[model samples]
Target chain A: MRATTLHGLKDIRFTEVADPVIEQPTDAIVKVIASCICGSDLWNYRGDNDITPGMTMGHESLGVVEEVGSSVSSFRKGDTVIVPFCHCDNTCPNCTFGAQSACVHLGFTVSGQGEYARVTQADGTLYRIDADPAPELLPSLLSLSDVMATGWHAAVAAGVRPGGTAVVVGDGAVGLCGVIAASMMGAEKVVAMSRYADRQKLATAFGATHVVETRGEEGEAEVLELTDGVGADAVLECVGTDQAMRTAFAVARPGSTVGIVGVPHGVQLPVHRMFRKNVGLAGGMAPVRRYLDDLLPLVLDGRINPGLVFDKTLPLAAVAEGYQAMDERTAIKVFLQP
Target chain B: MRATTLHGLKDIRFTEVADPVIEQPTDAIVKVIASCICGSDLWNYRGDNDITPGMTMGHESLGVVEEVGSSVSSFRKGDTVIVPFCHCDNTCPNCTFGAQSACVHLGFTVSGQGEYARVTQADGTLYRIDADPAPELLPSLLSLSDVMATGWHAAVAAGVRPGGTAVVVGDGAVGLCGVIAASMMGAEKVVAMSRYADRQKLATAFGATHVVETRGEEGEAEVLELTDGVGADAVLECVGTDQAMRTAFAVARPGSTVGIVGVPHGVQLPVHRMFRKNVGLAGGMAPVRRYLDDLLPLVLDGRINPGLVFDKTLPLAAVAEGYQAMDERTAIKVFLQP
Candidate 1:
């Protein structure tokens, strides 16, 4: 099997790797149909995260089941499915509560970027579609593995209710998806923070009612002003920088929530300020598997087009170019057809 | 008028001061029927907080309306009322949304420790009962001013639902009130963290199903064990210490909330941990005025006895002794008759 591996900063290569096989009774081997580079993937690509040389790189994928272990009775070969970023037993206390990301017997895979990936806890982590989805639905189905679910989690945790105002704090792929997620969740007004014209267009298309190109305090002021000076009822922090976190808190109403989904780096919360205004601070590693049962239908039926985030697609051999495009902001997301 | 003033660390003096008079058209002067030494007050008394010399001390109060300005239309002279610690012009966006403590035209009164207090924003901050109640009801009515309201805010913010598990993280007056609040809110099991015999007794009396006399990690372990290792669904942080805050987060299940009403002093959140598990961090200054309409009935109907927190009583002249008693932990709360 061919797989993408990181040799060093900005150095990604497609190389021959042993095909994955079911090693446990709970495991299943997925023949990758489609995969994508995530913004989180850039953390290691830019040398920001500790990247071990030759480590396989991807966590999101849509695929077909090649084989299942003896104990895996829910899925069979040729079945199309969405594989979540994290694998969980699903019967654990955390998984039972719909927080599969924090599952006790957690299994993670970087093999997602490869042609054949072994999926542990197949019955729990993989969601089978009633039938093989159309090729055009692949991007949206793949997104259900991570980004879309994460974006939806941000809106859900922020309590974006019907007729409420919602604010998205980033313009990345996930941020654009957040605009769509908030809209789907019945937020009357979705505000997107974006300075880039291209991303702003996508944000608007994804259902952003307003767009503010300003930054820092000015941006916060604009969001607050747009919400009648009371701030948005729910603010989604899609960018985890300290400034984004601060703006999320600053632009939320007293009883509202700031749901942060981006993996935080050096984000120290303004605890006193959040406390004083009673703003709820929530969201993290989203339980993508838990949300698939609900969000996949929207994707399958074309009620939502989250796949619009994939601005570029390439063959498995062009993996480096895909990463380069993402790093240089040439694409919101880059799909790799395996 | 005589008022309790902080002279220095551990030095409280009952000194003569100018009588409070209406300074705003929205103001009302109240002859204080009762005031109590709060656990928060001890911060200044113990030198943990900056002790401004001659600063009038006390925030909680229940009293009779002595005078009202022309604009004060809610009450008549001699009407008994509960004055929330934070005086807010309830029409502000924050107050209208049920966060009176963060009101735009916020007024804080420390004059409750005095013989008479000029309540600002009288129509918004004072809740008038139907009529003067029996002397036996004074203690409970007086508690509605702060501690009881604060405790109730903690439970409400934490989303304490019927048949859920609740954990209270402090053994002070407000913490004890939290146990009662959690029980009143329909939590099936209430766990109280206490190291003292007297406080433990009060906690059980207040409907604590279990009591754990440990601190920090050990205490969190006890709570997790009590809840079958799933942790509590709602954890109330009544103590502002960093340890208490950490334990509150540690003992809460995923998708749960840690409601902290403690006046935080140098508290830094473990943002990464909290984010990973999706534990919501919420609550701050209780909007007591907003809760008065709901909780007052509970007190009036003898459904709750939050006033049992006040174990000692003293005249205005013995204000210094009241502070001393609280400082020495000789009394959970000290009631002062002005």
Candidate 2:
């Protein structure tokens, strides 16, 4: 089976590997239908995160169950399902509390950009799609595996209220999806912070009522101006950089919360400012499994086209190209066909 | 008039000063009836926070309205009222959003230890006690001005739910009040982390179902053990130190929030752990005015006795002794009568 592996910096390879098999009684083999490169994947490619030779790459995908362990009861062979980036025993205390990402029996959906991938805790990790949808829905369905659900987590964590305003920081796929989530949650105004012309267009299409191309203080001022100088009712921080977090807190209205989905990197939380403004910080590695039930129907009904974030699509064999495209900012996200 | 003044570190003087008079069209002069020494005041006395020589002290007080400006409408002369530590217009965006501490026209209720204190934003800052209550209820009523309300804010921020478990980190006056708050909010189990026997007793009386005398990992383990290794559903961080904040997060269940009322001093937030566990940090300088409506009735009805946190009482002339008792940890809190 061909799978994406990282040897070192900027070295993503579509190399041959043994076909995935059930390693545990709770495991299942998934024949990948569609997968995509994530923003986090660029961290290792850019040497920001340490890489091990031949480490499996990718943690997002939707696929058909090729085989299941004898212990698996909820899913069987040939069943189509969405795999959340993180695997969890849904019955665990964390999972029951709607924080599946922190499940006591947590596992990662790595090696997903492959012909076949083994899924641990199969019954608790996979969400079965009831109907076989059109090919056009595949991208949206795949997004529900990670990015879309992550964006939805941000909105929920930020407590985006109906008729309120929301501000999304970052222009990545997750940020774009957050605009959709905020809009779908009934935010009267959705503000997207992006500098790129292409990303701005996609942001607007995804329900961004306002777009601020500026960054730093200027961007914060623009957002404040848009909200009658009071700041947004909710803020979605999609980029985990210090600057992005700063802007998130700065533009969050007093008594509002900032939903943070971005994996923090070299970020110093402005605890003092957050305290003074009565702004709260919530959201973490999103409990994607928890959101699947609510988000799947939205995608299936075409109420939200989160798949639009896939500005480019490529064959799984061109895995290196996919990583490079995302790294070079040439693609918002690169969808792959296995 | 004599007022409490901080001459320098450890130098508190009850000295003659100009009588407080209406300063702003929104201001009111209140004759101090009951005031208290707060834990934060010791920060200045202990040289932890910079002390401005000859600076007027005290922010917690309940008194009779002595005078009011032409624009003061809600409060009248001779009316007894609770003066929240912070003064807010209550009509500002932040105040309207229930974050009066961050009100756009925010002001502080300083010189509250004096015979008369000027309160800005009179219509918003003063919560008039509708009926003339007995002297016995004065202490409890005065607590609603700050500590009690601050504790309630922590519970509200932590989202204390009915039938849930709550862990309060810190056994100060505010933390004791938090126990009252958690129990009132219907938490099935209230855990108070304290090393002092006196504080533990007060905490138990205030509704703490459990007390852990250990600190750091040991304390965290005890709390985790109490909750079947799942941690508390809501955690109130009443101590501003890093250690207290760390314990607050450590004992918080995944997907729960840590309500922080302590004014953070050189505390480093564990953002990584918070993200991984889906634990959220909320609450800040409490919007005491926002909580007055709900808490006043509790105090009036004898449903709660937050004022019990004040273990010693002193005449206003002994202001220096009051600060000394709290600074040396000889008293949980000292109630001062002017």
Candidate 3:
């Protein structure tokens, strides 16, 4: 099978690799129908994160179960399902607490950008779809594997209350999705911070009631002004940079929380300021599996169109182009057809 | 009037000062009957925090209202009241949100160790008891002004739940009170991290179901072992040092929050580790004014005895000795009477 593999910096390639097989009794072979690039992937593609010579990439996907190990009971061959970015044993202590991202037997769903991928902990990691949906719903369904659920996690962690205000710190795919989550969760006002014209349009479409085309202190001031100078009741920090984190705290109201979904790079939290304002920090890696049940019905009913984040789609063989498009800011997200 | 004042590092003295009066239209002068040395005060006493020479000391006190300014409405002269350490005009946005500590018109109740203390925001800061209580209840009532409320804030912020496990790091007056808070909030297992035998006994008396005498890795291991290797559902970080913060996070279960009330000094939060585990950090300076209503009844009914934290009592003239006793850990806390 040809899969997306990273050799080094700025070098993503569609190369031949051995086909995925059942490696454990809890593993199942998935024939991936669709997958996409995550903002987190850019870290390794830009040399920010060290890369191995031939590590398989992609942790988001929706597919048909090609085969299942004998021990797998909840899913079988021909079943369509969404694979969470992280696999977990649902019965683990962390998973029982709905923090599946920190599951004791956690494993990443790598190799998803391929013809076939082996998913471990199949019963606990895969969310089965009752019927194979139309092609148009594929992208939205694919988002449940990671991005959309991650955005929802941010809103939930931030405690976005109905009739309150929410501020989203980043304008990336996850940030746009966060706008949707906050609005869907009933935040009366949703503020999106963005400088790009294209991303701003998407943010507005995804339920951003206000858009601040500024950064740093100026952006914080704009958000404060929007909230009658009281600051946002909830804040979603989708960018992992220090400046982004700083802005999130600066604009958070007293007793409010800043839910951070971004993977931190050079961020140092303003602990003193957070202490003074009673602003809390929550959220980390999203427990995608835990949110699947709530989000799937919304997606199936067309209540949310998270798939709109995928502004570009390409064949799996053009994986290199996909990475470059995202790296160059030409694409919000690139959906890959396997 | 004679009051406790800080002259320099470790130099506390009872000296003559101007008598406190209603300085603002909203001010109320309270004749302090009972006051106490707080663990936080020792920071200035030990030189960890910069000391302003001749600064009037003390923020915890309960007394009779001696005078009320023209605009003071809720409190009247001769009324017995609990003056929160921080005075807030509870009408501010922050105060309305239940974070009176960050109130727009926030002011610290300094001079609380004096014969009379001028408390600003009288209408919002003073909680009055129906009648003058017996002398025996004075110490417990004084705790409602700070320590007890601060401990309750930690538990509330940590989201202590019924049938859950809670871990409290630090065994100072506030941490000892946190044991009572966790137990009162219905945590089935309340663990107190302490090394001193006296503090351990007090913690047990305050409802600590378990105590870990070790520090660092050994302590974390013991807590993990006690919770069946899962970790506590809620954790109260009562010590502001980095190590205490680290242990609070280390023993917190996934999706649990660590409530921090200690004023941070030389502490750097582990943001990366927090992100990976989904452990949240919340709480700050306790909003004593906000919690007064709920805690006053509990104290009035004799449901809790947080006053036990004050192991030694001294006349206000012996203010110097109170500081030394607390500095040397010779007393858990010292209650001062004028």
Candidate 4:
């Protein structure tokens, strides 16, 4: 089987590798149908995150179960499924409370960018699609594995509700999907903060009622001015940088919540500021497994097109090109067909 | 008029001061019937917090309305009212959402240690008691001015639910009161963390189902062990120190909330840990006004004795002795009659 592997900074290789086998009684082997590069992948690609040579490269994918382990009762061979980024037992206290991302038995199953992958804890981690769908629906279904579910997590975590306004920070695919999420969650106004024209356009197409082409203080001021000085009712921090967080806090209304899902780097919260405004902060690694049940149906019915985030698609052999295109900002997200 | 003044570190003085009168159209003058020394007040008295000479030094009080400005329609002479720690217009977006403590027109009214206090934003800041009660009821009613409301805020903010377990950090009056608040809010088990025998007794009396004398990592292990290694459903952070915050986070079950109402001094959140656990952090300065209407009746009807925290009381001229007793840890809370 050919799988994507990371050797060093900026080094992505698609080469023949040993096929994954069901090592554990609860594990299953999946034939990958679709996979994609995530923004978080860039952290390792850019050498900002520790990366070991020949490491498995992706965490999001849609696939067909090729083989089920002895203990896997929930899924069987040939079942179309969405593989959430993290693996959990589902029956653990955390998973039972819908915090599968923080499950006590959580395992990072980041081998999605491959032709074949082994899934651990198959019964709890795999969400079987109800029926077979066309190949064109792969990208959208694959998104439920991580990115789309992550965006929904942000909106829900921020407590987005009817008649409220949501301010989305970041112009990446997750941020764009967040606009869709907030809108679907019944936010009357979805404000997308973007500086790039293409991303801004995508944001608007995804239900952003307003777009702010500013960052930091200016961005906060713009959001405040747009909301008549009361600030947005919910701030979705899809970007985890300090600047994005500051803007999220600044533009949040006094009683609003800021849901942060972006992998935080060097982020220190100003507790006093949040305290003074009575603002609440909640969001972390999203429980993608928990959201798959609700969001997959919308994609299946074509009510939402979260798959639109994939601006470029490539064959498994051209996986390097996919990484290069996203690295240079040529593609918001790149879908890979295995 | 006689008032308590801070001249320097450890220098508390009962000195003659000019009488206060209503200055703003929204102000009213109240002749204080009861006031109390707060843990935060000791910060200035102990020189931990910056203090200006002759600064009027109290924030919690219940008093009789002596005079009102033309715009003060909420109260007139002889009316009894609970003066919350902070003054707010109560019409701002923040106040409208029940976050009066963060009101846009917020004014820190700290003259409760004096014989007379000129209340600003009188209509919103004063919650008038239906009738003047006997001296015995004064302590409990005065508690509505700050401590009781603060504890209630912690419980409410932490999202305590029926059948859930709540862990209260700190043995202070507010923390003991939090035990009561969590119990009243339907928490099946209220765990109070205390080292002092007196505070533990008070905690039990205030509805604490269990008490843990351990601190830091030991305390966290104890809480986790008590809950069958799952941790508590809600953790009330009544202390602002980083260690306390960490313990609060550690004891919180996945998907639980930590409500912090302590005046934070040196606190930096370990966001990654919090995120990974799916633990939420919320709570700040309590919106005392919002809780007054609901809690006052409970106190009045003897359903809750929040005022039992006032273990010592002193005459107007003995304000120095009141401060001394609290400073030396001889009293849990000291009520001052002026």
| DockQ top scorer | 2
Where model 1 places Cα greater than 4 Å from the true spot, the runs are none
DockQ of 1: 0.77
Candidate 3 structure quality by residue, lDDT tens digits, A187-243:
999999999999999999889999999999988999999998999999999989999
Candidate 4 clash total? 0
Distance from true position, residue A166, model 1, in Å?
0.7
Alpha-carbon shift of residue A312 in model 1 (angstroms): 0.8
Q: What share of the true interface contacts does candidate 4 keep?
A: 0.68
- CA-lDDT, candidates in order: 0.90, 0.93, 0.93, 0.89
TM-score, each model?
Answer: 0.98, 0.99, 0.99, 0.98
List candidate 4 stretches off by more than 4 Å: none
Residue range B1-338, candidate 4, lDDT tens digits: 88888999888888888888778899988889899899889889988887789888788988889999998887899998899988888898889877899888787667899898888999989988866688899999999999999999999889999998999998888997898899999899899999989999999999899999998889889989888798999989998888999899999988778998988878998789877877888889999888877998899789899999999989868888888898888999998887
Positional deviation of B278 in candidate 4, in angstroms?
Answer: 1.4
Chain B TM-score of every predicted model = 0.98, 0.98, 0.99, 0.98
lDDT, candidate 3, B138-170, per-residue tens: 888999999999999999999999999999999
CAPRI class of candidate 3: high
What lDDT score goes with residue A154 in model 4?
A: 90
Could you give the DockQ of candidate 4? Answer: 0.78
